[model samples]
Target: NSHRVTYIHNLFQNGAATIAGVSEMFKERKRRGEIPADEEITFIMVTGDGGADIGMGPIVGTANRNDNVILLEYDNEGYMNTGNQLSYATPLGHATSTSHVGPAQVGKQFQHKDTIQIMAGTHIPYLFTGTESQPQDLIKKAAKAQWYAKNYGTVYGKILAACPLNWKNETRDGRNVVDAAVNCNFFPLYEIEQGITTLTYDPEAKGKKVELEDWLKMMGKTKHLLKPENKEIVEAARKEVERRFKRLKAMSEHPDL
Candidate 1:
């Protein structure tokens, strides 16, 4: 059947959570044959800024049990459609309309949510995290995801798109900004295959341990997170880098039989 069931969660702070709920609702509907089993089901999530959209990852994970779910995270740092409010994914120091800066103040104090990591934790057979700035990588990953969904009947891919308004840059500067991120080794392009993580590109030619400065400079929002005054935060960020590299090293060395 060509009929497509599209669920949109609007004005709701937790859109992802809403999606999860709807998936359960649909499951029941499908079981009763209210919707034909042979009909193709597609679940698509669209959100702007902030990872506060709860239930999104879980819904994708749940939907994957019987259908394919595609998740897209736009680069909009502020809630554009909803009066430029800050979402959980907003970076540390960006001056969002909701998170305005004043005397003796920092912008958004918290770091952005790592949705990729959250999705990875689900251990989905076919999952990917991509950015539109890297067109070739995005296309390749999308193709792989589609193939996985077709073969295994479940796949999830999270895409990162450009947000010129949030970045305070012109649309034309979007590519340059993404290029800077890649060149600086801030947004390292990589992929995970069947639960195996691989570094796709490394411009810095550094060791397994990546320097924190490379990524920090590109994300103006998180600059304050690494400031000298925030010694603890900086140290914590470094430790995270070390921990990730160590884990990757172990995985690379020990392959599954």
Candidate 2:
């Protein structure tokens, strides 16, 4: 029935509704013997961070990750496709359509949701973060996810995406932005296997890590942080980046934890 696949399209109004609809459709097919009783269905949940924010909290607590399911998150740090509006994934002190920085407010006051940590807390069989900047690394992680889901159990992969348009950057500059993010400690490359955490990419070979300012200036979205009056916001962003890096390093050192 590959040629006759059904389609369902909506504004993603409600994640719970989608869950129910998919389950019902699967059941109907099974009841009609379309799928053998012994066979299992592989459910892949591909969602932007927006949909995740709406239903993540409850689903993480309720869903069984140790099954034939994979959650692939294409994280661009905001609702990029939706006119640069702010989403739960938007970083702190960054300007978004919903969280415009001006005299009235200081951009998004809160940092990006630490969904990576939250997923790790689930203690699923596999969890990893991949950046488009590191193509081979991302490919490896994606292959691992597919292998584990088909062989062992479930896996979650959060892949960082770049939005040149939303970020007000040249198309070719997008890769450089991602590179700066990693070098500046804004987005770390790592994976958690079994109960152990490991760092996949490190920029320490260059002696000092790239400055956060370099990353901010790479995209227009974060250019506000470079203003003289916005120095404090820049400092705040640094503090957060350092804090998260420290936590991740600690986790890597203490894998059992």
For TM-score, the strongest prediction is 2
List, residue by residue over 70-171, the lDDT tens digit for candidate 1: 555664556666666787666555567777665565566666666556666766656665676778888888777766654554455655555666555667
lDDT of 2: 0.77
The collision pairs in model 1 are 17-54, 50-89, 51-89
Lowest lDDT block of 10, candidate 2 = 7-16
Q: Which candidate is the best by lDDT?
A: 2
* TM agreement with the true structure for every prediction: 0.67, 0.84
Compared with the true structure, model 1 gives a TM-score of: 0.67
- Angstrom error of the Cα, residue 150, model 2: value is 2.1
Candidate 1, residue 79: lDDT: 69
Candidate 2 on 1-257: residue-level lDDT in tens?
A: 45354434445434434544465577588899987777665556667777677767534743353554567777887876667788878888888889987899888988788787888777777888988889998888877777766676557778778888888889988888888998998889888887688888777755648999999998988888888998988898899999988888888889776
